[model samples]
Target chain A: MDVQAFKQRILPVQGRLFRVAQLFLRNREEAEDALQDVMLRLWSNRQQLETYQSLEALAVQMTRNLCLDKLKAHSRQKMATDGDFPEVQATTATPYQQVEAADSNELIHRLMEELPDQQRFILHLRDVEEYSFEEIEQLTGLSVNNIRVILSRARQRLRDSYTKANDYEADY
Target chain B: MKPTIEKLLEKYYDGETTLDEEKELRAYFQQENIPAHLQSHAPQFRYFANARSEHPSLKSINALANRLNAPEPNWVVRMGSWSVRLAASIGLLILGFGGGLVYNQLRPSAGKGTDLSFISETAPEKSLKQTLAFEQLAKTSASERIDAINQSYEITQADQEITQLLLNTLNFDSNVNVRLAACQALARFEREPSVRDGLIQSLKVQTDPNVQITLIDVLVTIKERRAVEEMQRLAENQEALDAVRLKAEEGVQSLNQAGNAPS
Candidate 1:
């Protein structure tokens, strides 16, 4: 896109881009960094964005791919900025106790850490973002059936980890 | 009735599922009946799809974009630095030249040098009278030369400069003709009180016996009877070498006979 068009059109996506960056990076500065980086990438390839049928999906994919690259770069730089703002690592505890605690939300978030990255990733696309199996297949290059099986198996794993140890479902 | 986990896995892999089928998969994992062995991996499926929605403010993005796209100021900046370097080099050149000028003004100019040669070439030509007068005195008696020396003697400042020049030239002139002329010119000064002192100095220290013999001849010719005692002293000195001592003795005898001879 021309400079004028790129500035006008892609500038609005800055919010969404930072959000995607924050999801992967989990911090303010890194999110900003990721937003700017993705903006620059999108601005540079604005012509490709014009050809895409789904602006939201493409932008989402672009932002997430950029976020992935940013994470890789963060790892390559030898210091993860994800928790620089103040984050506690998953503490030493069995999953049962972690789920039973009052911080069960954080506990659920922590469970994502234990899952194989692809399993967690498929579950996230399917359940959280509500992308269809076809979209997941497109995003991950996995077959639609493979996306389903992976999502199903991943859900089973989640149920097994978060279920109360005594087989009861009442409040802790 | 639903199949177990294996059946669910098979249906998922076969791409056969309703909305209820997916909900069942989620419920199956969310249920309390999951065995202990599989419980550890459960929340890996927390459907984190909505997590990427955080954002920075619009103001911050605009500020960052402005910083990234900032352009430098115009040519004045780049040319201005080069101009400073050029000015400094010129200033140093001028400073060095001024220092050299001051140093030259403070130092003495040796007489025989390129500056004198340049001055001589560039200075106005001398008047005809000054030239002829210089030539005539240069060929005249020492007393005449002494009278003529300082008339235009801006170039040299030695005391008794005329006598010094005559004596030096008489000793070094390659032409026997010039040597004879210098001797004849100095002959008159042999009796002058100052030239007599210079002649005595030449007799005492001069190693050239020929010049010594000629000086003796001039002393006798001029009847500088005052030099007799000095010649007699040189004659008796043991340090006087053979030929020079003999010349000194001859000079003394000539003076003695001249002193005693009738008028």
Candidate 2:
């Protein structure tokens, strides 16, 4: 984990780290924060690289854990502010009313904005990151059954929601 | 018994299936003969396995590489810092937020000492309060005094509270490019074990779809096997969002390749 080697090793994964941040925090700044924070830890803990059988796996573990911590802190901070922060608006998109301008993808994002945080969390990890049931179980502390049931329902809801949202739009 | 699609799907996420089983499952998914009831599940299942198949945005990666790769330039940095400071001061004067204010505002923060000067210049409204003493000293009314405080001493207030505060302010930055840049600059820090943990936590939970996609890309590049596992687990979770699960699957495939690569 010398400096240059570390850089080369992680350069391959930088995109991954940012993607994790983006997916979880839902904000580029937060994603970058997550990315930098993860990198800083990796740089400082160069000595501990030998502890894991796979450094890349270890890096993923580290990122997931870091994101969890950040998310918790963020929630706590948000509670402390008595809802004064404008963070909610940034994350929660207003459903666009105009049919012509609203694409299916945009409708989907809008629908996603309305789902409970927990469901969204599980869905992204399963579909986007493509972790295993056991892997998801390990990260979120949920059982494999719980993960599977949740994912099945999430897609159904998305397909339904997508259809329902654009029912009146004239199909081309 | 030889593996069937169901068995492979059962262990698909846990990494239990052999490489061959995975291929078989993918092949089954790609075929047109799946039962009608199972047809919907077909895409979802194929999606989880194929999730890792997505590519990430390279433009941002290249910029990140340039930053990480450009040697520290310490000696040059040491020598140039003095001139850079002087030149920056003159440039600030030309730009005229006052030399000190612009200088304080423009310098990249080290996340340690408070940049009161920068705060005073940038976040004056948040930094200033309507003190009775200030009211007495001023010729203005209470409302006017508040207005003056708001206008004159708008400090950005970098303090012990900065990490949280700056992290919060970072979200609403009017300039998307600056927001993106801050995100890029923060990538270096993922290397720390604690920050690494913090990042993982954030990625697991944050709700913004746009941001979620970005995180998936990072995981792919980092190739963290466990994070890949976490993502797969989420995909398997019935409660997980469709978009998020999809992103997780893509991340997993990317990491699988990176992880299982020929060394």
DockQ for every model comes to: 0.22, 0.05
lDDT of each: 0.59, 0.54
Fnat of every candidate, listed in order: 0.41, 0.09
lDDT of 1 by residue, B64-180 (tens): 577435422324566788899999999999999998997777664654475675565322112212322434545655444333333323333223545566665465544444444
Worst 10 residues of 2 chain A by lDDT: A78-87
- For model 2, state the Cα shift of residue B53 in Å: 7.8
| Prediction-by-prediction clash tally | 11, 120
List ranges where model 2 is wrong by over 4 Å.
Answer: A3-9, A53-57, A65-102, A168-172, B1-60, B70-263
The candidate that wins on TM-score is: 1
Residue B244 CA error for candidate 2 (Å)?
Answer: 99
What TM-score does each of the candidates earn?
Answer: 0.39, 0.37
